[model samples]
Target: MFSPKLLLISAIAVALVGSILAISSLYANAQNDEEKAVNSRGMGYYQTTGDVLDPAGSSGSASTGIEPMKYLRTFNYGRVSTLPNGTTLREFTMIADDRQTMEISPGVHYNVWTFNGTIPGPTIRATEGDLIRIHLINNGTHPHSMHFHGIHRAEMDGVFETINPGGQFIYEFYAEPYGLHLYHCHVQPLEEHISHGLYGVYIVDPKTPRPDADEMVMMMNGYDTDSDGENNFYTVNGVPFYYMHHPIEIEKGRLVRVYLVNILEFDQINNFHLHGNLYHLYRTGTDMEPDDYTDMVTMSQGERAILEFTYQYPGQYMFHAHKTEFAEKGWTGMFLVKE
Candidate 1:
């Protein structure tokens, strides 16, 4: 036996619990449907439901099979030499050549131009305020130059100082702006030079280091296999569909920092999208503050940004160009998060 007031309160509580459970079931169903839709789109390209391991395929003379950690994470600090005055100098030797054949994708080969015998060249890293030098050697028939995207003196600029066949030149400059940058061949028919794969990443680290994390770099590029002036195959770090099979492994709770660049020729714009989470984006990797907190970021040629994020749940996540064609054409990958 209960008082009339007590009975009313008990009835109300039961109805509230029933309503809450009903809402939860609906929400869970919605999540499942969304996931299924995403997987449906991936159908034959990639699968997020299985274990991802090192992919089995034909990589070229230089392969970014696993991307950044090997090709990019292995930074060339240059030959560090100290002066009599105790000043440290970083020096590099860059060679320009072309018509070298490389399998940009499985069963697809192209005549790639290179710096230091590799497409996208070497990842050059230096501290802000340091003096850096590049000794350029032109070993090919065509003239080539190293144009860096940073502040430097007029002569050090690689545009007018093109090196003819068998010739050499030196570019010396002070690293500044403490951000991500790039170097490329900037001769006449600039688009052709870049499209031919004559570029690499240049990084100037801030004096005060940012928070430590698992860091990596990505350079989005494309190849015109049939000379149609449009890209037939797109890639990250010179290989097609590399990371899709060999997912980037990371700890579940640690921060991941990515330095991403878009050097795709012909295409007006490209974009990067992360699945299951959003990230803080520092546009151009220049500012200390974030430009936006987003799941996708778009860029024009030579544009880059710094992305920082952490995953909460452990599983596989996909990353790709939000534009369907690019991802299907090979600009795609995955991240395996684990405890």
Candidate 2:
């Protein structure tokens, strides 16, 4: 007379418990036949498994270890000043390096190429019509270059600006068409460079400037662990499920502006969704007008937009990609609106 559904669930639970115990006991029965730690061969490099071949946990060659929370509000404003002709000049420096390990998830790691030693690099911000000067140093064994997504002269284009290892280049251009843009290594084998993590957000504020608000940058990206064409894990700000563990704290009833960018390689499109609110979507942030008032937005690789919203009540809300496969894999987060 017991309910059939209840009995089925009970049986499944018991079977699951038994399987877990069996798997645990297998390790206990495992005996070491032969094991040896291979050392030497004069390889002074890091691997994707978070191992520094030179010295164990050496601070000199250690990874940046940038946590998601710390990188959330980080922005690079550069040295700002006014030119004699009444224009803003922003000077910035970036170093390109390779053979750095970063954990994309718990116990999961990858060897990442970096700009200033972070996956998504630094958020470079400037005002419209400003003279943006970037000094790029190539410290990696491979040549690298920065191709910015904004209006600039042909000579300043990155394709021909590739810098050999131990070299440097100066790229100066005017920030035109105020919007949320992006930059990445444009060396040959472009996809390989970008997939290895040499990209960042570029923000050029409007001349009039947008309203005051809590602004944040979210760059949608992914990590391919197996050298396959498909991505194994996706992330926001370079860490999977980071916001879910440390929900973004925001004040209730405050305007929140998000400069969202989609730089996910191996995927045609990516998206964002909110659980309990809608936002005004500014496609590419080129104009002040909004193109849509919705809770979700889909963007292609290199596509970016600006979204503004306000949380009414204080609580925790989930935000993630509308694509179920992505959310289940890693493209998910939470926002905590505190009273």
- Compare the candidates by TM-score and give the number of the best one: 2
Reference-based lDDT, residue 206, model 1: 86
RMSD in angstroms, all models? 18.4, 14.2
Model 1, range 1-339, lDDT digits (tens) per residue?
889999999999999999999988887733322221112233444433333332232222245323333774667899998767766689999999985887677667788889988877888989887789999999987899999988899898898988998999989998888999998998988888889889999988888988998888889898888988899978787776777766789889899998898999988489999999999999877888999999999999999999999999999998999888888788888899999
lDDT of 2 by residue, 214-321 (tens): 999999998888988998888888877677767899999999999999999898499999989999999999989999999999999999999999999999999999
Misplaced by over 4 Å in model 1 are 1-69, 84-86
In terms of lDDT, the poorest run of 10 residues in model 1 is 31-40
* lDDT of model 1 at position 155: 91
Task: Give Cα distance to truth, residue 140, candidate 1, Å.
Answer: 1.6
